[model samples]
Target: MSGGVDSAVAAARAAEAGHDVTGVHLALSANPQSFRTGARGCCTVEDSRDARRAADVIGIPFYVWDLADRFRQDVVEDFVAEYAAGRTPNPCLRCNEKIKFAALLDKALALGFDAVCTGHYARILTRADGSRELHRSADMAKDQSYVLGVLDERQLAHAMFPLGDTDTTKADIRAEAERRGLAVAAKPDSHDICFIADGDTQGFLAKRLGQAEGAIVDETGARVGTHTGAYGFTIGQRKGLRIGTPAPDGKPRYVLDISPVDNTVTVGPAQALDVTELTAIRPRWCGAEPAGPATYTAQTRAHGDDVPVTAELRDGELRVTFTAPVRGIAPGQAVVLYDGTRVVGSATIAGTDRTGRPVTV
Candidate 1:
């Protein structure tokens, strides 16, 4: 249940609906102290305990399964390596795809559970033909279908999200948890990345990849400044650059691109961030192939506004052309496609012109 109010409420709702529900918390860390820094939730002994307490309150059994090794290999290592290759990776999406849906779903099926349920803010709808489709949650502000869109048809068939139908805000969830006397009722939402414990991505990379200095160049290939490491910066970054020189027009500069091969960070005006097209690789279709030459809305990041775009499947890739140029379309981020309220599918953004070229690890 992740020891969160949303999952706690979801479990209670499932149990109230007469489903035989058992709460399973994936213990994804070997060291207790390293995983529990009070900055982020999940993967700690205390979180498991809180989940068990919630399960007890709901009258269901709970178990903590050790998935530390798999989590490290699948999510942690991949996150570090993606950054090393000069790409901004979304580890949360990887956790949902590899750990939650793939690993946990298999374990749940082996334990003879009818279906797995999570507090994810997304919906699963069954078609008349007995197929499954993913949809946006009723709570638009909390809709997480962007990350959960990576699930295939099989995974969707055996998944349930009780919060999909409820228009409960975060305040409502906290109130419900408090009303039920749950311990995590008033716990502040976890902000930092879960495994890092400390929210210093650059520090983590520096510790892992030693001290490698590189040049920070402008868009015209002029060396503007020097960075300790190319992995420390990301697209759209503006602060912590330590650049002493001010623009001729006295305006601020933003990160335009990062070139790992040349070991350079490119800086330019904000307009340089505009990108009209993006290509996504390893696309996952939600249900059926979308109708030919479909027009839909897409989001490149969680909580990002959905922009109008035209999507077409070409040679195993989805090429998207945005109606209006968007900014900061980074590689290794997910591009989720939506047709109104229905989630069509999602794919990893491989590269964009504004971001230079794709770096594969």
Candidate 2:
């Protein structure tokens, strides 16, 4: 359990279903106090206590596993390195893939548990042919299928999402918790990245990578402004450029790219952000075969619009071709594919053709 209303209620629901349930809380950080502060975040000692209380109320055993070493190596290090490489990384997806599903699931199976359950707003469906598939939750606004799409067949087979079928809003969850007299009934949702307490990505990177002043240049490579660090900027960013000069067309300029080699942040017109095709690397298949080329919907970011796309396997990598142009398709982000509600697969975005090169479209 995550020590939140959703997970707490999920545990209660699972126990109500008459299954042998055990609550497992992951201690990902070295300092437990950092995870329990005010109304935000998890993985703290207090949150663990809350999770244990919820499990006790539901008449189940609860345990806290120390996964700090693995979490740092898998999620935290990957996040830091991705930013250093000038790509925007989704640490949550990495956590789901490496820590939760891979490590924790393995441990759960070893402990003789039938399946590991969580409060993630996604569903796992067993088809008529006995094949498992991942689907979006009933609540569209709380759908987290994009991040959970990274799970492979093995992980999906041993996973259970208790809150998937229930279309409960945040308010409904809080009300349910209160009705049940759960300890976390009034506990606030954990927002922002859990590991990073301060919510300052730029400041964190600067401390890790040291202060590296660089030039913020336009498309023509002319230095228009200066920034304290290149890791602070991301592609398609319009704010924080701190450029004193106005655009020639009297319009706002947007970040088109970040060249780590040159240590330059490239600014250009908004048109430069549009892309029709993107190359996704490190493809992961969830309960499906690697069928050659197939049509599916691809979502680049969480809460972003899903675009009609054609996915093809080329030289072992999945390349997605969007029917229309998409903006803000950043590298290191997960591009999740879905056939209606079932998640086909997902991959890390490697690059894009922002220049609008015409192909066989």
Candidate 3:
């Protein structure tokens, strides 16, 4: 249930629909006290208690599954490694792909469960041939299909989203929770990266990857400033450069690239962030893979705008050419392609083509 209102109501609805539902709260953190509490945090000790209470009110079985080691090996470690390699990763996607759907679903099936149901704002549509496809939730504002883009066809077959088809808003879900006597009806939703208790990402990275002094240079390869570590910066970042010398044109500079090999942070004008084409690997399709090159809307980041793009999967790489220049696209972030509201697939960005030159990260 994640100790949230959405999951509580989802459990209630699934059980009320005559399906035997069990609420499973993942104890992701080995030491819950190290995790944050209140609205900004999830999977904390308090969240587990809240989930149990909600299960009690809904008259269902509740269990807290300890997946801390798996989570650390998969999501947390992957996140740190990606950052250390100067790439930005989506930890939520990894958790959904490896921990929840893979580990949890496998365990549930061993215990004779049909599927793993959650409060995710996405839908699973079955074709006439019994093939399943993942689609966006009816509530586009609350849509989370981007994060779930990592799920393949096998995972979709055994996934359930009780609140996907509903057109109601998040507020309505909370109201439904109140009507059902769920204690988390008015609970605040968790935000940001849950594991980082203080919400200071730079500080967290510093703890794992000890600071290594690096030079921050401009487009001309001229040193502009210095930083504690190259891992602390990301593409398109404008603030915290601490550059003593201002640009000759008096314009602000943005992070154009992070070269971990030389441990250098390159800063340049904002236009340098514009990218027309990018190469992505590790493609995960919701249904059948694309047959050929086709036009689709590409979303580069969560809550980011979708742009018209032509994508083709060939030779184990997905090459996406955007009609318009996409800004702030990093190598490790996922590029999810969509046909209208249906997710075609997602791939991890591996490199980008800018000004007819290929830059691999």
TM-score of each: 0.95, 0.96, 0.98
**How close to the true structure is residue 3 of candidate 2, measured as C-alpha lDDT?**
83
Better of 1 and 3 by lDDT: 3
Query: In model 2, where is the ten-residue run with the lowest total lDDT?
Result: 352-361
lDDT of 2 by residue, 43-143 (tens): 76778888989988888888899999999999989998998888999998999999999899898889888788889999888989877899999888899
Determine the backbone clash count of candidate 2. 0
Which candidate should be chosen as best, given TM-score against the real structure?
3
Q: Please, what are the lDDT tens digits per residue for candidate 3 over residues 340-359?
A: 88999999998998766566
* Poorly placed runs, candidate 2 (over 4 Å): 357-361
User: Distance (Å) between predicted and true CA of 29, model 1?
Assistant: 1.0
Measured on C-alpha atoms, candidate 3 has an lDDT of: 0.92
The per-residue C-alpha lDDT of model 1 at residue 62 equals 88
Q: Model 2, residue 258: what's the lDDT?
A: 81
